[model samples]
Target: MNRNDTPNGSPAAPQASFSLRQLSDADWARFGAGEIAYLRPVTVNGVHAIAIHGADGAPIGAAPNAELAVAAILQHEMAPVLLH
Candidate 1:
């Protein structure tokens, strides 16, 4: 699931700051970093937890559950995607 440029998982075209076809290195590195977040189940120190990842496929934070994770993502104005 991707939000593309929108922060709510919407496919609606964004007001492009730059061309999508020829993304530069810096833009590619920050791909989706601001618009989307995702959740992955993980165990931290033997305790089950949900890991939050940015659109760039990097870990940003963690939450104990999906509900709180979603809330946190929303609070930060980023769309959340749940990974199975």
Candidate 2:
């Protein structure tokens, strides 16, 4: 018998699908108004690091890598975006 088949040869159970939430224009405006966190690259003491900044250009925090920086921002319930 196939692994996907049940005892009676029926197909396996259907899996649930999930989709991400789509932000509205107001939400994007909020994010642009310092309601979110942005990740930027910088040099600290001769070492490259990721710096977290608010939408108003204020320093929020820093991390050794982009992943950790994003995680830190998410932990604070804020959205993270990479700054060029």
Candidate 3:
């Protein structure tokens, strides 16, 4: 998700950061990198799992792998901005 901007076009608060509950090993593999970007938490089989939502707002899978990937992307991308 893109970050919110102020009226003057300066970066404002980041878009809401959402995360999945927790996911199964198999479901984690079903998700791809793109889907992981917008992952959210959801319940499955009475267990907590990471939920990957697409542009169409559909549940692609429970992507546990996304936790690290997303964080790495954010750290790499946002660190510069945050530091400055």
List residue ranges in candidate 2 displaced over 4 A: 1-34
Q: What does candidate 2's lDDT look like per residue over 1-84, in tens digits?
A: 798888999998966473325766565445566557889999999999999998766798999999999889888888898898
Which regions of candidate 3 fall more than 4 Å away from where they truly are?
1-37, 65-84
Model 3 local distance difference test score: 0.48
Top lDDT prediction, candidate number: 1
Which sequence of candidate numbers ranks them by TM-score, best first? 1, 2, 3
| C-alpha lDDT of residue 19 in model 1 | 66
Decoy 3 TM-score against native: 0.32
Question: What do the candidate models score in CA lDDT, each in turn?
Answer: 0.88, 0.83, 0.48
TM-score of 1: 0.62
Clashes of 1: 0
Residue pairs whose backbone atoms clash in candidate 1: none
Report the C-alpha lDDT of model 3 over 43-69, residue by residue, as the tens digit: 678876565444344543444555653
TM-score of each: 0.62, 0.60, 0.32
For residues 23-82, could you state the per-residue lDDT of candidate 1 as single tens digits? 887778787779999899998889999999998888899999889999999999999998
Alpha-carbon shift of residue 60 in model 1 (angstroms): 1.0
